[model samples]
Structure formats: structure tokens, C-alpha cells
Target: MKQLIKNLCYPLIAVLLFSACGEEDKSISAPEIVGAKLVSFGFYVEDNEGVLDKDYVVDGPIVGSDIEMKIPSKIDKSSLIARFTTSEDNPAVTVKGTVQVSQQTANDFSIPVDFVLTNNSQNNRKYTVRIKRPIEWVKKVRFSEFQLSDAILKVNPVDDVPYVMGITNASNSENRKTVLLKYENETWSMVGDTISNGRPSDIDFTFNSTGTPYVVYTDYTNTIPQTATVQYYDGSSWVVIGRNYNDVRVSYNSICFDAMGKLYVFSMNNAAGGVVGRRLMNISTYNGGSWTTNQTMPGRNYNTYNMRSILKKDILYLGVYDYANDKGTISVYINQNGVWTTLAQGMRMDGATEINYNDLDMDVDNQGNIYIMGLERFDSGYKLVNHKYTASTSSWSIFATPIDLIGNTKYFSIGLNPDGGLSTVYNNLTTNSNSSFVTIDKESQTWTSPFIFPDILNTKADMAFASDGTGYIIYIDASKHLAIWEYIEDNE
Candidate 1:
């Protein structure tokens, strides 16, 4: 009995030892990684999807050039599934599930198998990184001829209030005279003579400080060859400025009232030359009670024909044409410090033979800088031309290159603003299409491309630029209607 008991004790002790050994080997360890999450996408490379660091490795051909994940040998073996989903709206790719092997002691395992990847959906992938392409330039607001009344024939006597006033014909027959139609307080009224029947050379209306009205026009109403008749608005009717005709044989004139309510009129008079057949400028001053006239332009034969006069900052800028040879010439006479001085000249095309009377144009800025635009005969055909005058050096420079901005057309008008910018309106003779508008940046010496008008045969147009650089194009509509198109911003 004692021997049997000893044998049992030994066997029991051996079993206990084996149990202790097994527990030692089963100590708890760090959890094995079973899957990966998509951390982020990498740089733009061909066919690259975002790297997955959290999802289980499902397929053999892992998407990117990098690894998915690894597994520990201690974890229970199961099917590892990885899902690749697209983020954008693409129809070519399909999301599929696959299983991949996770090796123990391996850093990150790549699926050895290869599968076709459609980048059509890869572009759809939402990445934290994105790029935007640059935008191209767009041509907006263009110029068109608004109206070409007989009044606009005298150089540039046309001035529209922009909002309410526009150009209209005084006569409706085969011979139409240009006149100004003004709308004040919602009422349309004729400001100047429609017929200008007596060959009224220049008609200018001015506003008093208190907003009263005054006018100056050349008429033969009182004299035989017709003296320049001056009229003033006394709140109701038109009254002559003085008791007698002050300006006689006035060729061209401009009227303006100063801050003190004083009336001033500058004009060109047919001069008897120390040499004959010359022209001189006569300036008239009027207070509320009296009138006076004096010769303002003193030079002899300075080509004062087709003179355009403007007042800026209490000074007068007279744009005289150099028609001594029939071609166009623009000489700027500036009134400064109580004396008149020749400020600048836009004379680049003077030597060109093809330039004609109808082709000449000129405008003066508030600083007396002259801007001249015209059509020049090029290659036996007329082409658009542009030039500028520098006030400091009294020099002229060509502001347009290639001359295609205004297109190859005839009978166009040029408009200039206080800034050096200019605009041109011309009939697109080829298509007889609507007019084309061209704008030039005198500072940058660049031109925007032609913006074609949308109408057809809107000819005999006139244009004017305002202080804000906004302009008006007045033209006679096809229905014989007066049309005004303006440049405005497009919200779209």
C-alpha cells in the first residue's frame, strides 16, 4: 500500500510542473494591429490613391506605392478585407473587396497581385490639396455711335448731360441741322435752334451757379452777314446778353459762366491779314449788366478753321485745326496766368498725304493735354490712327499700334475723357453691321480689342465721354428713331 501511494505522488508533482510551464508562456502582450485607417493622400503621381493605414489589408495589389499594414502572429488568423472607395463623381471605377495576407514580423505588407486601376475615379478622390487654374481676360463694355446730327458737324460742339440730354436733328428733311435736346425736371425742351437756318455757327448753353440758364449762338437776326446773337435765360424767356451785337463774323465759339456768375464767350473772327484772309479769336465778357469783346487769339493764319474750344479750371483750351494744307492738324492754345500759350501739338500725321479734312480729330483734357485721333491712308486704304501730346515737353507720341482696334472703317468719331483714355466709334462697313467701339489707355499706351455693336446699320452716330470715363453713343435708329446706348457693368 505504501509503494502505491509514492507512485501517485510523483505523477501528481509532474502534472503540477507542466501546468506552471504553460502559464509562464501565456503572459499578456501588446494588442496586434489587425487593420489600418486612411491617414492622408500623397503627392500627385500617376494612378495614386490615398494611403490606407487603418483598414485591413484586403487585396493583394495594394493601391499606392506604400504599405497598408502588418499583423502579429499571436492574433487569431482571419480573412483581412480592404476597401478602396472613390470620392468623386466618376462612373468608370468600381469598389470591390479583397483579402490579403498579414505576415508576422513584417513591417507593412504589399499585396503582390496587380489589378487595373481606372484614374477616371482617382481624380474624383477628395484630397486635402487642390489647385485652381488661372482665368482668361474678357472684353466688356464697348463704344457705338449714338447720334450724328448736323450740329456735330462743327468740330465737337456736342455735349450731352449723359443722363437726360442727347443729340437730335433740328430739321427732318434732306437737309438736317444738328441741335441739342435737353430734359430738365422730366421735361424735354429744345435748347438751340433746330434749323440753325441762318448758318448759326456755334451754339453753347451754360448754367449759372444758382442753376439758371444762358445761351450763345451765332445768328443773322440783327445784322446783314449775321452777327453772333447772344441770349440769356432770365428764368423764363431767352433774352439777348447786351443791347448791341458783341461778336461779329464769329466762325466758332464756346460759352461758359464763371463762379461769380460772369458770362464768357470765346470765338474766332475772320481777320484781315497784314496779310489778307487770316483768322483771329474774339473773346467777349459779360456781367449781369454789361458786355465786352476783345481779340483773344493773336497769331496770324494759325489754321483756326474748325476750332474746338473748352474751358477747364478757369482756363480755355482752343483746339485749332492745321487745315492750311487740307489734311488734319491739331494745335492746342492754352490760357494760363492771364495769357494764352501754345501748350502742345498732335502733329505726327502732318507729313502723311492721305490724311484729309474728314479724317482729323482733336480733344483737350482738363490739364490741356491734347489727344488726336483720325483715319490715315495706309497701303492705299484708310486705317485708324491715334496720338497723344505731353503737356510737360510739348511732344507727340503715337498711342496706337497696328491700328486695328478701331477697325478699317470710315466716318467714325473719337471721344476723350479728362484722363488720357480715348474711345472710337465707327461703322463696320463690311458687314454694314452695328458699329465697333475701341478704347485706348493713354497711360499704358495699350488698346482693348474692338467690341462690336449688336445692331445693324446704326450709322451717322455721335459719341461723347464724360468725366467719369463713362460715355454716350447717340445714333439714329433704323426706324428713324433716336437711340442711345450706354456702357454699363455686367453683373454676370
Candidate 2:
């Protein structure tokens, strides 16, 4: 790409001469130097702020002085360079400087050079140049199985975070392993790993108001019936808070906390095929010490598949599929006298008839309201349903389900903004195209497409949002490099 350099100089006198690139010419008059500095070296991208390599400092390139500087090329621009300098001073002071730009690919990328210059005046003189280049992301996003993938991006208070914690298998080989991730800084890194056979699944993690980090996931290990475990990180390592050996295979697990910092782990489980006669659906709670297990209400059990579980405040909720009737139902349980009491029975939305609803996803807001997003089937076709749970009366309110997400059946993920609004992302396939996006006003009772991300194609990776309400989509690019896309909201 072409580089535009401004020269900010001092006086009206100016001289234009073209010769092989050389050093700043000290003989240039004060006015020439000031005027030249006026339009110092700069770069820009359409509609974006100029991001010059601020690491470099330039007073001016003397008309005849040779100067060297390193500048970063915008990835979107073709490899090219342009140099220009000005000699303009706002306070009628003489200024002179030289500017140069060059292109460098990833292999030959050069370090930015700093031209240290003095104002030469009794007072300090500051010359500035704004640079802009095409916005570029990392070449590839690398993934490894059997490891945790947590990416902590820069925290901007105004953004609604998408997803923070996710479990992904970096590779698709026979030795595929599960990876647990936690985001801390601007990068997503591995934190914990489970055996390949215990393939990590249905993971939920969150940091309480006190900054205590907690996570829950199901591990399908041979030793114990595939079980759910709770882990907490105390600024150092992940420690298992609770472990069960009841021969109950757990699935579709989630973690949440109440206003009192109590931990709750909700998971769907089935008895050992040979031992227990009936499948068991449960919500387990840990009060920083012991674990208490609670089973779901009658009619909440599904003989064939897993159920999605979530907790808001002190109440527990679950969404299960009725394989027999081909319909989906939600149930809630409340704790009374330290025991979980079934508060509601199979509650179905107005038009929810199909029972084959899978990939059920749920989220809870600050006001103790619960929202669930999942795939639904109908005689005519398949559709998506985003429903809410009003805890005040233990009721279910079916919100608008966007039809655009019909194809994004698997890998469905959701989160909430600090204001209790909802956010969601999933993969959609269209013949040869794939796309994903977050829902608008996620917690609203209404459904509309005010904000939708561009369709992302061919991604076999996990996505997450930061806590500040901004959504970040992470995936491995064609070259296997981690690619990050930030969805930011503007302040009115």
C-alpha cells in the first residue's frame, strides 16, 4: 500500500527537490523545516484512525540528512513504502525531519526504528505523525486437545462479553484430547486437560463477584461412571472442589453462583446401565465444603438423551427432551429447608410440540430470570426457540425464536451482558457456507435481528465473549493460526 507522510515545518520558505532517498538536510531554512514538519510522515486506513508506529520519535528529517526508521505495514495493504516530511511549527518555531516507509512480510518483518532528536530549543518541541494501516489479525489460531482454552482479552468496560470459558479438541486425530481454557489477558491459553476417553464436554465457568473462579464439566472416564466435577482456581491452579463416584454418568453440565457466592453445579446424568433401574437427572450444590445432590421432578426424566441444567439465584432449572412425544419441556426446583423441592412440572411453550429438541442452551440474568436457546422440530420443519423462565411465579415465557439460526444446530453457546441481556453464537451451514452471530437484546421477550455478525465459514473451533459485554469469535484460520473478531457496541 502507498504511505502518506506529512511534513510539519516552521516558515513559509519551501524547497522541493527529488533525489535518491537521503538524510535530513540541515541547510533547509527554519521556515522550510517548520513547513516540512507540518505534513510529517503519516498513514491511514479508510474510516479508521491512523495507527502509526508510535514507538518511533521524529523531530524532522533534515532536508539533506539521512535518517532511518522502521514502520509497520498494515496487513491489508500491498507491500509498499512512501516517505514525506514537513517543517511546520504551530508557534512559529523552525522544524525539520525526514520520513521513510518500507514493506516487510511476516518473515522479514523489521523492528520499528526510533529517530531520537532534540527540539534544539530552550523549550521542548513535540512533532507528531498519525499512521494508519489495514487492520490485520494473527495468521492462525492453534488448538490442542486435552487442554483448557481460556482467552482473556483486553477488558473494555463497555463491551458485552461473548463467551469466556470453553472446552475444545485442537486436533481431530484418533488421540483427540479435551482442553480446558481460561481467558486472562488478551490471549487464550490452556489451563487443564482430561484424558481422551474422558473427553471434556458441557463446560461452564464463571468468576464470582469476589473474583473466585469456578468451573464444572463432565468427564467420561472408565474408572468412574462418566461424572461431573467442580473445579476452582485460587490464582494458582485448578482444584477439584467436589467429586462423586455414584456410577451416574453426567452430561449437559453447567455452573452458577447465588448472591451469597454459593456454588451450584447442574448436570444431566443416567444410572450405570447394569445397576440402577432408572436414569437420574440431578443438580449438585457445593457450599465451599460439602456437596448436596438433588434429583429432578417426575416427568423431567428422559430415557434416551441428555438434559440441559442451569441455576439462577438459589433456584435450579432444567430443559429435557421427550423422546417419546418428540417434545421439549422445562422444570424448576427450589430449595426449602435445605432440600430441593420441585416447584414446577413439564412446562411447554405455546407452540412447542416437537420433542426432539437437542443442543439445549440456557442462561440466567441478574434478576433471577432464566433464558434457554435450543433447536426445535415441527411437522413443517426444524426451528430454534429462545425461551425465558420467570422465577417470580415459576413460569415459562417463550420469546421470539429467530429462524435464521435453523442451520446452526450444533455448537450452540450463549452468555449475558452485565445488564442481564442475552448473547448467543452457533454454527450455521448452507450447502458450502457457514456463519455465526449473537442475538440482539438476548434477554428480551421480543426477537429481532438488529445486530448480526458476518457469516464465518469452515470453522471447527469454540467461541467466547468477555465479561464487559463485548463478543469475541475465535477460530483457526486456514493456516491454523488463531483468528479473533471483536463485536463492539457503541455508547450513545
Candidate 3:
């Protein structure tokens, strides 16, 4: 850390030397009066046409004439504009004796530069400014004990707190109960009663209009035509939805609430009402009294494996891994109005069956375009790519993916950023010697440096965002304890 000192000149020439430390030099002295003091300073990144790119303003008090600016180390500081304010109003600031204008003068700051602040073209103060990339404002990301033995995590967009739904005590199956926990004040506490007796194959939650949480899951114990159930806590006991909707046995359930607060559960075999075969997929909705079932896309024997969905306004998108034509391929179905259509039968090159497939993840942006992070066989090994579906063109194209993510990583998930940006996220827990959750923001088109988990065990991780842009990442660690990161800022 370098510091600048406020030099009080006693000679006409003001030959004062500033050290890397905060010490002022009395050697080779030649000034007699005090020069203008720089009150504030900032380094900015701008385009060639003077459009502001990024501004690195000094965060703390500027001591004397030493200004220490802190910015992210990843940002390039080679060509940058300097902006500063002087104690004297509208004083001319210069670097290396060339006349400089604040916010207009560009300089190469790969090394420390000297700025001379002149009060009236006569009295000037030489200020040495140094920049540092400080990663200390926020705490270091270290995994701590999270109480949920097994869990699915979510963050409320309104409250910005992490809400988890999973098995409370997995080691003791007799006493284990599916529950929801809210993380607040550095503690995990139960929000509602025990949801179920044991862990289900797929477990997730959604919020109703009144902000009440409603969870949906498949019954893992009943493999003899399993049952899909939805429940919510009503201040006391757990209230089950569609319990009387007849034999609604299904598995791999994912849920969400529409703007009308209607609960829509996407699963196979028409779990909400109709008892179809395991090949048919349906979207069941709860309408106050009874739950109704509607086939999402009819006549297609959709593979129910890894079934997931996302509904925004009128557009509803569903994705599943299809094993048709004796080859596993990624399949997508879309519902715009009342009509459901197939976007792609098999998302392979010309629907070829020679490709081996892994799991798939899909999300919808604000503009209703769908994105799929589908992993398939590419070249000699499996490759995962982000495919974007354009509604206007009715076509799917590959987006820029700088890294081989899904196939190479242990666990990879794609989700929409609910903080109101149309951006999507690519989060993966890498299989490195020391695993890290590498979160790639789609809009940035660059890789985000991940926080390393030194002894991470569980690759399962979930991320949620609050309204204030705070992100909470929760996962079970190698110690079978719930772990979390407040994630105030990007590591780089």
C-alpha cells in the first residue's frame, strides 16, 4: 500500500520528493508557498467517443495529497481517463507538465503517474496517486456449516433471504422430515412444519401471490405408481393441494406460480388430474377448488427424464431428455397460447442418433426467448453448449460459450437472473482438486472467477438473488452440513 503526503513547499521551485511510503522528503528542496491540494480523484474507463465505461472513484478519505484508488484487479488500467477535484475551484490539473483536463485527459496508468494541480498557472502542488485492487471490503468466501442435511435453496426476490426446502436429517431416515428453512442473522431456522417424512426424487418450491411458499415433490417411497404432491404452510399445519384430485402418480416435478397465483406443476403422466402413461407430460394447475390437468404437447411420447419447465406470462417452455430413435437427445416443447408446439424433436445435428447425451437445463429470458444448456457428444468427447431460441425467427442458434461447461463439470445449472435483468446464469461446481462454484453471467460473455471451496464435497449448489442484487449460494458440504456464501461481489 502506497501513501501520498501533503507537501508544504518552502522554496520557489518546490523540489519535493514523495516516497512510496507516506514520508515527505526534505532533500533537494526548492519551494516557498503551499500549492493547491487535490481534494478528490478518480480513474475512469471510457470509449473512444468519450462514453463512460467504468469509473474507479476513491472510496475512502484522501489523506493530504496521497490518493489511493481501489478497483477490481481484473479491469484493464492501461488506457484510462483521470478525473479529480481540487481545493481551488476549477484549477488546471496537469500530468508530466502537459496541460490536462479532468475527465478529458487520457493517460497510461500501468505505472504510478504524477499529477500537478496548479491554482492559477503559478502555485501548484505535485500529487502522487497509486491504485490498488482491494478485495477486502467484503469477507473472504469460506464455506461454513449450514444445518440442512440435504436441501433445495431459493432466495426471495422481495426479502433477499435464502429459503431452503430439503430433508432436515438425512442420516436418520425415520426422523427425517422435508422442511423449509430461511437463512437470516447468520442462522438457519425452520419456516414451516415438516413437509414430508422422507426425501423425494425432485423437490422445489414456488411463491403464491401473497408471497406464501408452496412446495411440490414426488413421493419417493411409493414406486408403485408414485404420487406427485404440493403443499404449503398455513401458519400451523402443512396444507396439501390436489390431495383429492384422484390417482395423480408422477415423478420429476418442477413447479411455478403464474401471475394469477395459479399453481402450475410440470410433470409426466398428468399428475394433477388425469392418469396417463409415463410417456405423456402434462401441466397441472390448481384453481381454488380442484386441480385441472392439460397435456402440454399432445401425441408425442415425451421422455419424462429430467423434466423441467419455466412459465412467464403467456409463454411456457418445457424441456426433457428424449430417448426416441434409440438415441438420447434433448427435446423442447413450448406453449404460447392454448396451443402447445414442439420446438425441436432432437437437438442434434440434423437430429442424428449417433450422439450421446447428458442432462439438460433451460431458462427463459424477459423477451420470452428460451435458452438451453444442452450437453451432447461433440468431436471425441461430450460438449455442452448454450442454445438460444428466438421467438421471431422460430429458430435456435448457438450462443458464445468460451468454455466446456456441463459435460466437463460435476454439476451445471442454468437460470434466469430474477433481479429484473434479461441475463441468464451458467453455474457449475467444477471437479477440480479444490472444487469451486464457477458462475458465468451470460450477458457479460466472460468467465467469472469462482470462489474456491478447499474441501468441498457436495457438488449440489443453488443460487438465489434478492431485490437489492444480493446473491445467496447454498449447498451441502463434504461434512454433510449446509454451506453458504453471501456473495456480495464478484471475485474478479
Candidate 4:
């Protein structure tokens, strides 16, 4: 009986030893394995049928250790669910030390997030998931106070709020006066008295660095063979800046401030004794006290249509049209040490040559790249184009996809945004299409589909940037009233 008890004890001990081994963690003896990998990743809509305009459900394969998903503009990124799968069975996925369940966890994906995955064999892998949401630019009105009879002559953007010049005398029956308007407190109101107190013909407005408004204009009612005049806003009243009127029959005139805050006015005056051109193009500069004649531009013959002069990098850029030499060539002159030099030879726009008066606009980027906005003639229709000239290479090329952005336009304005992107304010002459503002980055070849206007036409459309790099589209509306729309980003 004792021998039998001893054998039973040995069997019982064997069972007890096996139970003790089971109590130990099995993972401690786990074998090394090949690393697990991320198989797929996605974010799906809960109520896919009714929540959004369309299903934004994005699910895709993982490439290497990276994953990405693109969403529509204005979509919220703070609260997003990331559903993913792994290659191995019983895999454990964690983000910032928190265990994750497939399609069951919400995360803040405003920026890129990293994830770590572990498989049953204790193998691990890491991945980075990024969400790409395109920016949404919105357009809102900044000014709305205008009478049907009031004519919006020009809009000049200052630091934050802008200033606009208008004609209170819209018709010949009334006494005409140039009025100065200010955009402040979300609306446009009169800042001071009338500018010229006469009927202004050609108008250009700008603000100096010290926040003083200056206007260079031609008044036909007050003076015969109208002279180009400059005016400034002096706290309480609008007064003429310099009394040095050349009286050489100034017609097309513009105003610009130099790097030193000195004001310069360029005008198309009648041919004088020493000046060149069929119409003498004169450059007049104003010292703080008085205005003085600077010099006449060379090679100013046979060019009739005068665009505007813009200063970039302290260099004066003047644009004009030349028909005698080339096929509607756009002549751009840069003042280098007081000598005018031609840039990129001259760009051509065949369609503009046929018209006696055309609206061909020019703007320069911070990089000193010149851009001329005009129309190219085609058998089907006139296609809007932006002819770009690179200052570094001295080469000219048409921007990609202008036809798709503005379609066939009768008039348009092309300007570079502060972010180095190209933007257009175009009159869409397409039968069923509306006017729009399309912005395309310098690197991207295609457009991203932008703001659409309400029945904006071949009316005066100008694109300007505000102090904070915000873009504004200024145009004459259907009622012949001035309209300003600004671009704002919408992030949901």
C-alpha cells in the first residue's frame, strides 16, 4: 500500500509541475519573427448617403511606411477616424501609447500622425499617416455704399482699409467733382472733400508710406487741352500736390511712389521741341515741396495705347503698345540708372492690334517677373492669356491652362498673389459661364477651381492684394457701381 501511494504522489507532482509552467507568461518565450506591415488605411463617412454633398470615403493601400489621404476643402480635420489593417493576425496597433481598434478610434488629424503596430510574434513596424486638405478661398464684399449715378473711377489699396476715387457727377447736367471715398468699419464712406472738384478723365490713385493719399488725374471740364494734376489728402481737405503743370496737353497719366517716397507722374503729352514720340511721354517727379520735369522716354514713337507704370525693386516698369514695329507687341521699359532698357524684346498679342482701344493690363511680381494680360486670336474665339517673362532667364512663356481658367474673355486682369501664385480677374465671355477668379500656384500646372462672380462682364476688373496678403477683386458691377470682393480662407 505504501508503494502504491508513492507512485500516485509522483503522478500528482507531474500534473502540478505542468500547471506551474502554464502560469508563466507565454510571451516571455515567444520567438522572433519577420516584421509586420500596414496593409490598408481609410476614413469612411458614418451616414455616407445624407451627410455630405458626396461621399468622401477614402481608403487606400499603404506605400512603404507612409500613408496619405486627400479631402475636399473646408472639411474638419480635428476629429477624424482612422481605420486600418495589418498583415499579421492578432496584430496590436497603437498611436501615442494608446491601443487602437480598427475603425473604432477617433484621432486629431490636423497634422500628420504616427502609428506603431505589433504582431503576435512580437515583430513591430512604424508608419506615418498624413491628411491633405486643400485651402478654401472665399469672396466677400467690403463696400456697398454707392448710388447708381456715382461712377467708380479707381480703387487703391492701402495698408488695411482701402481708398477709392469716384465721380459724384455721373451725368453732364450736374456739376462734376471727384470724390475721395474710404473703406473702413466694413463699409465705404467719404473721407474728406472732393478731390479735383472738376470732371476727372484719366484717374490713378495711391497712398504713400506715411498713409497720405495721392491722385494723379486729368480734369477735362476745368482746363482746356487738359493737364495731368496731382492731389493729396492733407488731414482735413483734399488739395493739389504740385502746381508745376507742364500744360503740354497731358492725356494718359499715372502716379507711382518711389522707394524713397518721392512721387512720380508719367503722362502722354503733346510733342514738344526736345521730346521724342508722336505724343511726348513725360516723366515728372515731385520733391517734397514742388514737382519738376525729369526726362522723356526714348523710343516712344508709334505707341498709342498707354497702359500703366508699376515700380518693382525700385525699378520703374512702363508698358505700352507698339504696332508699327511688330504685331501688337507689348513694349516694357525698365529704368536702370535713369536709362530705359527693353525687356524680353516685346511680347505679341495679335488680337489687340485690330482694336483702336484695348484693355491690356500689366503687373509685376516680387521676383521682378513681368506679366502681360491680353487676348490671343483664334478662329473659334478670343482666348485669354497671361504672357509670363522670367527676369532671370529673359525668356517668355504663356502660363498653362489660361483657357480653362478664364475661358474666352473680352477683358481680364492678371496679378501675382503674395504667396507667389497667379490670380486672374477675368470677364467670362463664354455663353453660359460666369466671371471668376482663378488662382494657380507657380509650381502646379493645372488650376484648382476658384471663386465665381455674379454676372461680372468686360467691365473694369482689377485684382489687388491687401496688407496681409489677402486678395481683392475690384470691378464695376451691373449697375455701373463699384464692387469689391475679398478672398478669405474657410477651414472647417
Candidate with best TM-score: 4
**Model 4: clashing residue pairs?**
none
Better of 2 and 4 by lDDT: 4
Q: State which candidate, 1 or 3, has the greater lDDT.
A: 3
- lDDT (Cα) of model 3: 0.61
What would the TM-scores of all predictions be?
Answer: 0.55, 0.55, 0.65, 0.68
RMSD of each: 24.8, 17.6, 13.4, 15.8
Residue 257, candidate 2: C-alpha displacement in angstroms: 3.7
lDDT of 1 by residue, 1-492 (tens): 889999999999998998887876766688632223223222211221233223333344334433323332222223222334332332232223222221211112122222122343233221111111112222222222233333332112233343222233435433433344543232335554442344454555555555455556666444534346666556445566642344346656566655445567766666452122345556677876777776455563555544555555666565655555555555667665546677554354544454444434566666656676666655545566666777778777776763542334545777775455677777765545577777774334577667777662646556666554445666555654455555532221
Q: How close is candidate 3 to the true structure, as a TM-score?
A: 0.65
TM-score of 2: 0.55
What lDDT would each prediction earn against the true structure?
0.50, 0.48, 0.61, 0.64
What is the C-alpha local distance difference test score of candidate 1?
A: 0.50
Error of 3 at 207 (Å): 1.0
When summed lDDT is taken over every stretch of 10 residues in candidate 4, the lowest stretch is 146-155
* Number of clashing pairs per prediction, in order: 18, 105, 9, 0
lDDT of 3 by residue, 200-311 (tens): 5467787665557888876645443356767888877788775434255675677876555557787766344455665466668887867887545575774655666666
The C-alpha stretches of model 3 lying farther than 4 A from their native spots are 1-81, 84-100, 103-149, 171-175, 220-225, 244-248, 269-275, 294-296, 336-341, 348-358, 391-393, 405-410, 418-444, 448-451, 490-492
Superposed Cα deviation of residue 251, candidate 3 (Å): 1.5
lDDT ranking from best to worst? 4, 3, 1, 2
30-69 per-residue lDDT for model 4 (tens digits):
5644657777777767533232343444355556776766
